[model samples]
Target: MGLVVPFEDKNPDKGASIESLVSLVSADMERVNAMILSRTGSDVTMIPEVANHLISSGGKRLRPMLTLAMANLAGYHGDGHVKLAASVEFMHTATLLHDDVVDESDMRRGRIAARIRWGNQASVLVGDFLLGQAFKMMVEVGSLRALDILSSAAAVIAEGEVMQLAAAKNTETNEDEYLAVIRGKTAELFAAACEVGPVIAGRPKAEQAACRSYGMNLGIAFQLIDDALDYGGTSANLGKNVGDDFREGKITLPVVLSFRRGNDDERAFWRRALEENEASDSDLETAIAIMHRHRALEHTIERARHYGAIARDALELFPKSAIKDAMLETVDFCIARAH
Candidate 1:
C-alpha cells in the first residue's frame, strides 16, 4: 500500500498570495529596483546586457521585499533599508547566474539561462561582478553588524552550493543531509535578508533573531515546496522546465523519501536513473509514478507545512500589524503554491 499522508487544511483560503507583502513594500521596492538598475550599468556593454536579461525577468523579488518589509516593521526611518534590499537582490541574482552554470541548466524564469545565452565563461564572470557590486552596497550601508550577517550568509551560501555539488547524483543522500544543504544555500540568505532589517533599524537583538528565525523557516518551507513541485508542477508554475531536477540528477527530498521507501526494483531504478544519469525520455514519468506510489510529494509538502508553522509562530514576537500579517501570509503563499 502507498503511504497515506494526511495534509492539514491550515490555510483554508488557498488563495494566499504574495500580493499583500508586495503592496506593503511597494514604495521601498521602487527604490530598490531603481538602485538595482543603476548599479547594473557599466562601461562594458555585455555586463549590463547579461545582468539586465535576468534581472528584468519576472522574478517576484521576494527576498528584497522581505528586507524592506522587515525594516518597515521595525519602524525604520532612512534609506539604508533600500540599499540593503538592493544588495540582497544582487546577491540572489548572482547566485542564479552561478547556479545555472553549475547545473548546466537551459531554462530559468521561463527564459534561456544566462549561461546558455552567453558562454559559461561570460556567465561566471558576470556573476562575480554582481557579487562584487553586492558587497559594495553592503559596505556603503556602513553597519558592521548588518555587513557581518550578510557577508557570513554569502560564505554559508557558497558552502551550501559546494555541499549540493557533492551530494548531486548520489542516490544515498539522506533527509538530514538534504536539509543541511538547503539551510546553508537558501535559508541562510533568507535569514540574513530579514535580520538585517532589524539590525539597521536599531531594533532589539531578540527582534532580530525572531526575524531571522522567520526567514530561515520560511526559506526551508519554500525550497521543500519547490522540490515537490519539480515533479508535480507545470513549467509555467515552476518558472523552469518541469522535471529539470530529475534531469539534473538532483537528490531532492522527494527523491530521498521515495528511495528510502521503495522496493528493491525501485531502488535499482533510482540508482540507474539518478546515480548513473541513465534516465530515458519516459524515465521522468516513471520517477513521478514512483514518487506517487510512496506519496513522496504529499509528505514533502507536509514537511513544508511543519516549517511553515514554525515560521508563522516566529513572528509572534511582534505585535499585530499589517506588515506582520503580510509576512505571515507570505509563508502560507509559499506553501500554497504546491496546490
Candidate 2:
C-alpha cells in the first residue's frame, strides 16, 4: 500500500504509461504537491523532518493520482479534486510509515526508511499527524459523502493492519484470510480514494460504484504483484530488499499456496524459515527455489492477472478517453511487473 512505483520499464507495451496519467493531471498534481508540502510543515522541527523524509522521497503518489484521474474520468471540473487528491496522498503516506514500523522494514523507496532514520516512535507519531492532516483536508472539501467514505476507509485500514498482525507467522492462514487482509489494509483506501472522486464530482451512484470496483480490484492486483515481486524482483524493481515478506514472516498468497501444496519436508522448511523466524539470505534463496518448484509465484501472478482483468472490465461503462485509457494501461502494468 506504500507508493508502488509501478513498472518503470521503458517499453511502451510493458510500462503503465504512467506518463499519460501524469500529463493529464500535471497541473493539478503540482497543486497537490504544494498542498502536501504546506500541510506537512510544522512548528515542531522533528515533525516535518520525519514526515518529509518519506514524502520527499521519490514516491510516485499513485493513489492520489488515481483520485485525480478518476475525477477527470468522471468529467469533473472543480477545485475539490485537488484537495481530495492531496488528502488521499496523505492517507497513503501515513500508512507507509505505519506499515514499515509494523513490518520492521529497513528500506523504503530505495532509501533508509523513516522508522530507521527516526525512531519507531517518531515514525508512528508522524504517521498519526499525517492522518490528522488528511482528515482536515477532507473536511475542507465540504463533501460529507466523501468524508464518510475516506473516514470509514481509515478505520478499515486499521482493522486490516490488526488482522495482518494476528495472521503474521501463521502458515495455516488461508488464501481467503490473506485476501481479507490485503483488501482491508490495501484495497480499502484505493476504493475510497477512487470512489470519493466521483462523489465530489457529483457523478451518479452507478459511476461511483464502478470507480470503487475498479480501484478495489486494481488495488488487489497491485498488492498481488508486489507479493510476487518480493520473491523475484530486484532492488531496482521493488525499492526494497528481496525476500522482505519472507523475512517478516508475512503469509502472502504465494506462501499460502506453496505451503499448502508442498511436501512434508517443504512444509517443514516453511515452518522453520517463516513460522520460526529463522530465515537467512541463503534460506530465502532456497525458499524462492521451492516456490518455483511449486509454481507459487507463477500461480500468484495468474491470480493477479485475473484481478487485473476484472479491474479493466470494471471501467467498461466509462467513455474512452485519455484518462480511461491510462487507467486501463495501469492494469496491464500491474500484471506485467510480475514478468
Model 2 RMSD in Å is 3.5
lDDT of 1: 0.92
Task: Report every candidate's CA lDDT.
Answer: 0.92, 0.88
Query: TM-score for each prediction?
Result: 0.96, 0.95
Backbone clash count, each prediction separately: 0, 0
Least accurate stretch of 10 residues (summed lDDT) in model 2? 1-10
Give one digit per residue, the lDDT tens place, for model 1 in 210-291: 9999999999999998998888887877889888899899999999999999999999999999889899868988998898
Model 2 clashes, total count = 0
Query: Lowest-scoring 10 consecutive residues by lDDT in candidate 1?
Result: 1-10
- TM-score between candidate 1 and the true structure: 0.96
